[model samples]
Target: MATWPRREYFYYFTKMMPTGFTLTVDLDVTATKEWLAARDLKFNAAYLYLVSKVIAQTPEFRVYRDNTGQLQRFDVIHPAYSVMHADDHSISSLWTAYDPDFTQFYQNYLADLAEYGDQRTPMPKAPQSENTYMIGSIPWTHFTSYTPLPFTPLNTFFPVIQAGKFEQEAKRWQMPLSLTIHHAVADGYHVSQFFEQLQLAFDHPEAWLAS
Candidate 1:
C-alpha cells in the first residue's frame, strides 16, 4: 500500500473525486467469425473467452479491494455474464471459473450454460467469486457507444465489457466494443494497450482458439 505506485491516485479518485470513463471502439472480427463458423461454435461464447483472456492477462484490469479495505490485484479475473431466457426474455446471471486454456474454459462455459442457462432466477449458476468481472453482449443491435451504470461507486475498478452486434462493412466484419473502467486503477494508455491486445486476439484467433 505504502509503496504502491498509484496509491495517491487511487485515493484521490476513490475518495476525493470519483471518476470513471467508458470508451467504445469498433473491432474487426471477420477472421474470428470465420474461425468459429467453421467449427460450429457460438459467437457469444468465443467473444467472452477472448475478452476474459485479455482481461486476465492485463494486470491493470484486475485491481480490487479486499474485505479489510486494502487494495489488491487478482492474479486472474473470471467472467460474470447474463444468459437470456427465451420464454419472457428474462436474464439469468451466471459466472464460470476462467481457465487459461481455451478448450477447458469453453467446456466450462458449456457446462454452466447447460445446467443454468434456462433458469430464470437472479442467482448465479455457480458461486460468484471475488475475482470476477462483468462481461456481456447485445447481439440484436449495433451501437457506437454504451455506458454501464453500476450501483457501486466509481472505485469499482474491475472493467465491464460489452459487445454489440456485428455487421459487415465493405469486406470486414466489425463489432462495437464498449469498455468501462475505473480511472483510479488505470489510465488511457493502459486502456489503449488493452484494446490493442484485444484487437490482436480478434485478428489472430488461431493463436488462442483451440483448433
Candidate 2:
C-alpha cells in the first residue's frame, strides 16, 4: 500500500466566518462635478471600482464572529450601487466578494482607504458575501441624489430623492455606509483602512483613478 503524504483539512479552523462585526462609513461629496462632466457615468464607474476594491481587501471590512470561532479569513466582498440603461434610471450592483486578485486589490483598496480614515465607524464590518446585488440603470436629472450614508433601505432613499428631500434626508441619515465582511481572512482594521483609503482617493481623485 502507498501512503499519501498530505492532509486536506489540517488547518480547517481558518475557513469559518465571524459574527457581530459590521462597519458603516459616511462619505460626503457632491456629484455636481460628476454631473457636469460629459463622462459623468465614467466618473461613477471609476468611483465604484475604486471604492469596492478597497472594501474587498481591507481585513477590517471583514466581520469576525465572537471569540471561540473556527475558520480563517474568507477573502471576499460585495458591492451595491445604482446604474442606468435603456433610457430608464435603475439601480444595480457588482459583488466584489471573492475577487481572486487580492494584491492588486489591496493596492487599489489602500489608495482609497487612506482618505476617510478620519471619520467614525458606525457599525462593524459584516462578513464577506458570496452573493451580490445589481441594480439596473439610472438617468441624470435635477433631482439626482448621490449620497454616501444612511444604511436606510434603498426604497426609502429613492422616494425621498424624487420628493426633493435628498439634502434633508442625507443630513438625517448621517450618510454612513454599512458593510458585513466574512471573517475567514481579515480582522477589524481593514474597515478602518478602507475609509482612510477613500479619503485619500477623494482628495486626489485624478491620481487615484488613473492608477
Best by lDDT: 1
Give RMSD to native, each candidate. Answer: 1.3, 14.2
Tens-digit per-residue lDDT, 75-163, candidate 2: 54444433223344332222233233434544443443344222243212234243333211223222333333345322111100111
What is the TM-score (0 to 1) of candidate 2?
Answer: 0.40
lDDT of each: 0.87, 0.37
lDDT of 1 by residue, 1-211 (tens): 7999888998897779888899999999999999999999888778888998888888889987777778788888888998988879999889988888888888999999988888879865656677778899998999999999888453347998998998999989999999999888988988899999999999999997874
What range of 10 consecutive residues in model 2 has the weakest lDDT sum? 155-164
Model 1: worst 10 consecutive residues (lDDT sum):
148-157
RMSD to the native, candidate 2? 14.2
Q: Which stretches of candidate 1 lie over 4 Å from their true place?
A: 154-156
Clashing pairs in 1: none
What local lDDT does model 2 show for residue 47?
Answer: 47
The top-ranked prediction according to TM-score is 1
